[model samples]
Target: MTVTEKDRDILARTLWGEARGEGLAGQIAVAWAIRNRVDDGKLKSWWGEGYSGVCQAPYQFSCWNKNDPNYAYLSGAMAIPFRELAQCRGVADQVTDGRVPDPTGGATHYYAIAMPKAPAWAAKARQTLKLGGHVFFKGVP
Candidate 1:
């Protein structure tokens, strides 16, 4: 549970990529989902090793995908807006440091409400929260 700077950076970038438009609360929820994955003892293998591992794991968060529009910014190939990234970094630090309560209610998965249709997995999972433009869920099958 020792979060390194790499972990913080990756988590911050992930928040920036995934939920920047949703603002601080939304970003915090997303961060908790990643943290939940990191802290899940039962599914550790599936989620990868830690914050960086889980964020960069293949096909989990679409922003990490090479073809995604956010990839360049998230990967540092393109510069992210300073104020936005700083806000995301603050959320990342608070979430990773256990300073913020999980608004996602132990959610390990989420999808933008703007999607044409919810992901198939969402049907099997328990919905936790609906905040900003996303829906949070846990116990995804």
Candidate 2:
């Protein structure tokens, strides 16, 4: 399906395992996405199998830097939309060092995921990976 018609959904698949810690948050954070073939209990079935949880809030992402020597040089070589990059940054935020790029490639917009108990970043990465993209997780960040 085209990115525009994705009807996208985000799921936070805790990288460290957010199994209820302190007042909240636990060991890890992750996100995931699932669409088109639903079996009613699909989400619940995959909750632990692959998905850690879901992100029920807005996320931030960018694509340029004005202070850097490469000012106007798309942040991290990202020239995609804030969301397209957001899907990448969400995961990169916790996976890579300084993955959060500057917001300048496009208009900044926020969208909500259906999952509240999960990290939104992880969920977005999963969706992009499913589309044949490579997402490397950060080590011991």
Candidate 3:
């Protein structure tokens, strides 16, 4: 897919919001998950159109949810820490441009390992990769 500047920025913001503390590999894993969603062939609406669409799709990435603590930084209501945001942006660019491989093995979903419990969708899905604090999954309905 041809990634525009807007898509790149949105992906970067999503990485910053979702996995900033997880470092570069974590950010790339998250990016792969988002790209996997874009290629899922299920969501055909604006929500699945491209990088921006997949990242902003409601409930897909919790960081964009109104109730999420990261929403403020993601929506520009609060300032993201400069260094963290820059790192996310750099990773976003690399992932989108194919400089990094899909380390998550086409995973379309993931959750932080610290979560009290894995979501129901993860119960039967194929675990693809584990990087930093998150675990990636695929083949979920």
- What TM-score fits each model? 0.98, 0.17, 0.93
Please provide, for model 1 over 21-131, each residue's C-alpha lDDT reduced to its tens digit, 9 standing for 90 to 100.
998889999999999999998877788889999999998999999999999999789999999999999999999989999999999999999999999999899999999
Q: Which stretches of candidate 1 lie above 4 Å from their native place?
A: none
lDDT against the true structure, per candidate, is 0.94, 0.24, 0.88
Q: Point to the candidate with the largest lDDT.
A: 1
Per-residue lDDT of model 3, residues 46-112, tens digit only = 4568899889887788899999999999999999989888898899888888888999988888999
| Candidate 2 least-lDDT 10 residues | 19-28
Model 3 TM-score (2 dp): 0.93
**What is the C-alpha RMSD, rounded to one decimal, of candidate 3?**
1.4
Deviation in Å, model 1, residue 45 alpha carbon: 1.5
Candidate 2: stretches off by over 4 Å? 1-79, 97-141
lDDT score, candidate 2, position 126: 25
**Most accurate candidate by TM-score:** 1
Candidate 2 lDDT over residue span 1-141, tens digit each:
222112122221221112112111111122222211121244443322211122222111111124433223232343334543344334423322223332211111122232355444444432221111112122101
